[model samples]
Structure formats: C-alpha cells, structure tokens
Target: MDVIVETRYGKVLGREEEGVRTFLGIPYARAPQGERRFLPPEPVEPWTGVLDARAYGPICPQVANPLNPVDGFAQSEDCLRLCVYAPAEGTGHPVMVWIHGGAYVFGSGQSPWYDGRAFARDGVVLVTLNYRLGPLGFLHLAHLGGEAYASSGNAGILDQIAALTFVRDTIEAFGGDPNRVTVAGESAGAWSVGTLLVTEAARGLFQQAILQSGIPFQYRTPESAEWFTAQLLDALGLSPSSWRRLFDVPAADLVSAAARIPARDGLNLRPVLDGVTLTQSFWDALRDGHAAHVPTLAGSNREELMLWVARESEWRALSDEERIARVDRMWGPLTDRARDYYVDGRTGDELLTWLVRFASMRTFTYPTIRAAEIQSEYAPVYLYRFDYRPSRLGAAHALEIPFVFGTYAHPSARALIGERPTHADVSDAMHAAWVAFVRSGSPQAPNLPEWPTYDPKRRSTLIFDEAPRVEDDPDSAERELWSDMTSLSM
Candidate 1:
C-alpha cells in the first residue's frame, strides 16, 4: 500500500488504492507567495527528507463557484501542486495531464470531478495540478508595473508549462512515458490546451491535446487586459500611480475586488496578450503550423452556453425590447440581418432555443471549428459534438465531464447526467474513445464509428450521444450563422 519514488526535486511517499498508485500534492513549482506573487512560476526548490504526499495540496485562493466548489481543499498563494495516478504494474504507460476549468476564475486540480482512478485503471498515468487563477494569476500588470510584471497576465499559462515540464522530468519514475504525454482540459482549461498548442514555451512538452468546449482564441488583448487591470486597481481604491499597493493587498481581498471587475462585451479577467509570452493569436499560430507536431482531439457540448443561461429565469422572461436591445448591442448595423436569421418570427422557447444556439456558435462551436480547420491543414485533427441531453435541460457546458472521466456517480456529475442506466453506457463508450485517442493518434474505439480526420472538405466529426456516430459537417447550416462574422459576439 505504501511506495516511495525519488524525484529530482526529492523523494516522496505515496499510497496504492485498488491497482493504482496515487501521489498527491507534489509541487511542480515553488510557492508564488510574497515577492513571487504575480510573477511567472519558478522551478521548485529541491527538498530534503521524504515528503509525505498523502493529501491534496492547497489550491489557489479563489471565491467559490456554486457549481464547481473547491471547499474541501485548503487554499493558499503557494498552490502549484499536482496529483498523479499511475498503474501500479506498468512502465512507460501513456501520460495524461489534466488542467481543470472554472472560467479561469475558480476550480482546482483537487476537484472530486477530476478523480483520475479510472484513467489509472485503464493503464494511463493521469496527473492533475493547480495553477493561479483570476487576478492572482492573470491580472495584466506590465502596462502598469513595467518589466517586473511583463508576464503577469500569462502567469497561469506559464504555471501549466511548468507543470508539464515537471511531468516530463519526473513522471518516468512513476511508470509514465515522458514522450507520450497528452495535455487535456475542459472550458477554460480547454482554452489553456488550445493556447498551449501555440505557446512557444510549450512546443515539445506535450504530444497530443484534448480540448473540450474551448478553442485558442479567447484571450484578452493588452488593451482589454489593461482595462480589466485598471478596473481591479480602481476597485482596490488605488490609482495607476499606486499600483505597488497591489502586492500588499490580501489575496482574498483581490478575489473580492476581481468579482467586481465588470465584464465588458463578455470579456473576463483571463489569459492576456502579454506580447512576450504569446506573440500571435491561436489562429495565426495554427496557420503557421505551431501545433503541427501534436495530434488534436477537440469539441464542444451541443449547448455550451446553456449551462450559463438555461438556469436563469431572466433569460426566458426577458421582454422583447430588452432581448432585442441585447441583440442590437451585439450586432450594431447588422442588427436586422441578425434578427432575420435568429428572430424572423420565433418567440418563446423557439426564440430562446435560437438565442442559445447563436450564442453557442459564436462563442464555442465556431471557434472550435476554425481551430480544427486550420490545424487539420498541418496535422491530424479530430472534431466532435457532444449531443447527449442528460435531460430536457440539454447537454449544457461541462456536462460531458462525468462521461469523459467516468465520474457519473459523483453527486455533481449525477446532477448533470441523471440516474439513467444508459448514462453509464454512454460514458463507457466516450471514455474509451478518449483513451484510444491518447494511446494512438486516432480516437477509434470499439463502440465508435470510423472517424476520419477533419479537413475543410469532409470535416468528419464524431458525435457522442446515446448512439455514437460519425457525421460530415453536422449542423452545417447552424455553423453558417457566423459565416461573415469578422468579429465574434463573445
């Protein structure tokens, strides 16, 4: 039940459960406390003595999200920790490093939803880690703080690279193949994976990528990041000249102030275009073959935005004037043209459905397709659409987490997938495809149909539902809704 592994940083103790060996709370980078706050991650200092790796480490300081809470775990500024689940009896097993998503604000590697036991049982070494979030990890400060804060906005992203670097150097001791590491995440985590695909620092750290409901292009430009920073500083009652006070403010207070950072045109405080860490957009990088070496499997749930809008009564009860005004704000001069496509004569649930679809396409689906199309030109890319409606609520964002990770029985997952026996069956099929994709370059599984690589022409996409099938350009009509959108709504 007990095991010891000597890593370059130090020796650590771990435990075995069932047939999998788990090492918890392994620090990949040094604690970013005190002066290190808002800076890129530094290499973990080598430790003496056998460190006990028995519990999940502290997660980044964050406000709790009702849907994805990290309450059980302790939190701190020194939260760059990782958990490893590896097969007890294998060497050179495929490795999976999972980055969690909570809109770049909340969520942790320690979430029960990310339990890696299933991956371990299936002969994969699964690793999950915590990184800085919200203002602590992504507050754009270079514009205000000069060279010392040049990489401040991308600190979270650099934390991921640091974790990947740790895996490459250390996972071999835990029976994992460093060369076969696959980076995977959902939502904001997916955005990180997509961003990693193009990041120069992450060029060779990963071999494959799995992005669920995010494509690389969702970052704040320097102007937007600076605006958000100004908002944050203002919330703290400080001016541009008083930026130094940010370092002295408590993390909890920063989180509180960040909550007040008003969203503009749907922008949130997330990874920024820090000119240094990332030079080009995901689209440009893909077109230039930055991710050509990595095979990719990416997708979005059918109703990604519904997770945000579906539960709100205001979305359904909006007066026509209010809802139409919302559309006008987004469409501007093209408002009538947009209404013709999404409005025309629809109302009530029909109109709500169209609105949700339009939101999904503009934000998630269209960007996903664009990433795939551009990346497919240089490498093998597989696309998917998760269409399983766990209930009439529709397969909203992050609903596929239960199926993808075989965690349906988790209370939160159960809430999303329901108690249907078929949910497990679908999970089995989808999980197998994900495992297959990680093992080989293709996602061919026993239950899945022959899935062809995505090209602009065929655009073959594997649809995961009660009945898994392959479709060429599924929902092409809906996809065309954003055909002329030089700019996306999100």
Candidate 2:
C-alpha cells in the first residue's frame, strides 16, 4: 500500500514493506541548473499536489568510480534529494541522517549498500541524502565571480544543510523527532560530518554525530583554490577573467575536465576555507572547543590505508629500503623511531604488512585520535577501532560499513570483506552500538564491552572484534611518534 505523508513542501507518496515505510527521491532543495549552477542551495518551491517518491532520485553528475562501481542509477544535475525510512508504527523516533562517501567525487544516498530498513527495524528513522559532487559542487571561483558566487566552493555542504533543514521541518510527519537528529557518514561523508561540526549554518540542526573512518584535514585557501581554478580554466581553454563562461559549459564537459586532473597532483576537489561559509579551519574550531556541544562517536578501521595500498602495484612492490625511505619522507624525524616501535624485526610479507599498517596509522588513525582528543574536551566522545580482520582483506578502509548497517550479506560486502562468511554476532554488536549511540548519547550494546568516554588521560577506545574489548591508550607509542606534527599527509 502507498503511504502518504505531508512535508513542508507538499504531500509525498511512499511505500511500506515489512513494517518499514520508505519515502525516496524527495527533493530538499531546488535543482542547481541554469542560473543556480555553482551557487549555494536554495529551498524547494512548494508543490500543488502529492509528489510521487517511490523511486530513488538521479545521482549527482560525475564519472563513475573505477575502484568502486555503482551501476543502475541514473545520474543528473537535479540530484539534491534525500530518502527516508521509518518504522511503520512509531512516534517521535530518534532520527539518523546518513551522508554517503566517495572522496566527495561519487556515490549517492540511493546506493544499495546504504539500505536503511535495518535501522528502521531497530526503532531509528534513517535518512540517506544526495549532494552535489566534483567541480560542479566544490570548484572555487568566488574571487573571480564576486559576491554572487561567494559560496561556490561549499555548495555541496550547503546542499546537505538544506536537506537537514527539510528533515528538521518535515520529519515529524514521518514519525521522527526533530530534536533528536544524529548526523553520520563514512569517508568523505564523515569528512562532511566533521565539517558540519564547525560550520555556523549547521549549528543546532543535529544533536549528535558519528564519524566513521574520517577526520578534518586541509581545506583550500583562496590562493590554493584559485590555483586549481586556473588549472580548470586552462583545461577548458577559458581565461580566468572569462570565468563567467563556466556557467554556459555543459555539465559533462566540466566533469570530463575534472576527471582528467591527475590524482598525484594532489588536486582532489574539496571544500574551501571561504571567509563567509567556512570562516575558520575545522581543526581550529575543534581545538578551541567551538564545535557544537553534542555527544560524538568517532572511529577508524585498524588498517585504513590498506584499501589503497592493496590497489597500488608500485606500493605493493616496494623494497624494504624503499618503504623505509618513503616512510621517512612522510614522517620526518620520527621515521626511525616509528620503525623500531612498529616494524623492527619483521621481514618479507610480514614486513610489507607492517609497513602498510604504519602508513595507515600515519595517514588515518592518528588524525582520528587527534580529533577525538580535541572533541572530548568539549563533549563526551566515544572512540573505537574496527579490528575484525576478514580472510582476504584486513580491517581496512570502509570494511565496517556493512557491519554497521547490518547488511553484511549484500553483494557490495564482497568487494570490501571478500566472500568469507560474515559473523552475525559482530554485526549485531556493531549495529546495536550505533543504535544505542543514536538513541542515547552512549554506545551500550549488549554484546559489546562497556565503551567509556575518551579523554587524554585514559585515551580509552572500544576495539570491535569477534570478542569486543575496551583498551586504554592502545598503540600509544606510535601515536606519540607523530604527536608534534601539525597534520597528516592525507
């Protein structure tokens, strides 16, 4: 049977299945086309009749990821939409809004891996949303375009805030509590959650956050952003002074030009430190305890960088000396001490494994630990390490998502965790912990150990493995090795 609900914009017709009601492809903001392209998101106009929301919306325009391919979803510019899943019979349920991750380049709320029925089954209303991606969403042309495009660099994030605003205003009709919204995501999505923490516009829209496998890092200064802008303009044969020409270029042409930018140039399109939208660095806001005072749960996999390392042929083929030299170049004076602490006597594949592990710590783990340390000063922060090592892949990047969503049997889990059988008990534990954290401020899963709040004194963290346990200051020596560095080379 079709389920009809009234949003602030108009009536939306959804569908119900197995005790969960799902409303899909509901626009939260106006389509960014014509005059709206590259500008901050604006509210959707009220409609005259019921909007059919039974299908997932078109994903944001971008080239498909070769590493992680998403098939069967239409892509378009009019993709600023969100999906909702709520229990068939509930009132004022805690809401969990999910932002999908793809390095801010690809992915969408409609990705099959993010199905929210499990969350609905657990009494939490789950929402997954789509935002703009690539140059269309993040390219910084504000200085050249003037005040009219001041927020161009952060248009994607502005899309997210608009979606949250829609949720805060309209979720109650779907049996959700506007006051108990928990925003969460992984990878770039987690980056977005962290960004929202410091963004003035996102304040009070969410009451808590869950950052899975991500931390704050460099946002472009206008100078650096303009450097990228120059590169893009050069790619398109348009001069900087002729920046207005960008508005007329076909979206496909823009995406094609963006894809040609070499990854090694460190030219990943990202949010910029716009003086208006993002006035200060996320690190500064976090360090000064200026972040929203909400309970937070932050964590990363035990071997995050391995996902990339496993794909890089040259990195996998590095000789011990080459690996050591590379580590030295990245870690500075701490290289030798870190090797002694983490890789001393190991050789061959074991040595390679250790090398990858250290790289993961330097690039992913330490940053998350630093974020937790800073965030804990202002709010209760729970830290965790996903330690379940699958047979083929270790506890690598994004390996925890399926487990968190309780969708370990999904085909997408194969690319991440291999064909090995998933342990239901582990998924039960992790998903329950997420539910507990969303419902209350604490992660109190029955199958897992008591997760304590993180503080610099104890540096406590929950280790999620077959047998979950709590450890204090886990991997303390390696963490200390890079303590003096300002940021990781992410």
Using all chains and alpha carbons, the TM-scores for the candidates as numbered come to 0.96, 0.94
> Model 2, stretches more than 4 Å misplaced?
263-267, 318-348, 419-422, 484-490
lDDT string for model 1 (1-490, tens) is 8999998888989999799999999999999988889999999999999989988889998887667566677879989999999999979999999999988889998887889999999999999999999898888899878998999999999999999999999999999999999999998899999899999999899999999998756578999888888888888899999998888999999998898776884546777778899888777778888898689999998987678677667777787666666645542323445678877798777877777777777678888998888888788999999999997568789989878889988987776667887898889988998899888978899888899999989889998999999999998876665666556522
Best by TM-score: 1
The TM-score obtained by model 1 is 0.96
Q: Give model 2 RMSD, 1 decimal.
A: 2.3
Residue 379's lDDT within candidate 1 is 81
State the lDDT at 464 in candidate 1: 90
Candidate 2: tens digits of C-alpha lDDT, residues 211-313: 9987766677887777888888999999988888998999888988988876532336878898988998888878766674889999999988677767778
Give the Å error, residue 310, model 2: 1.5
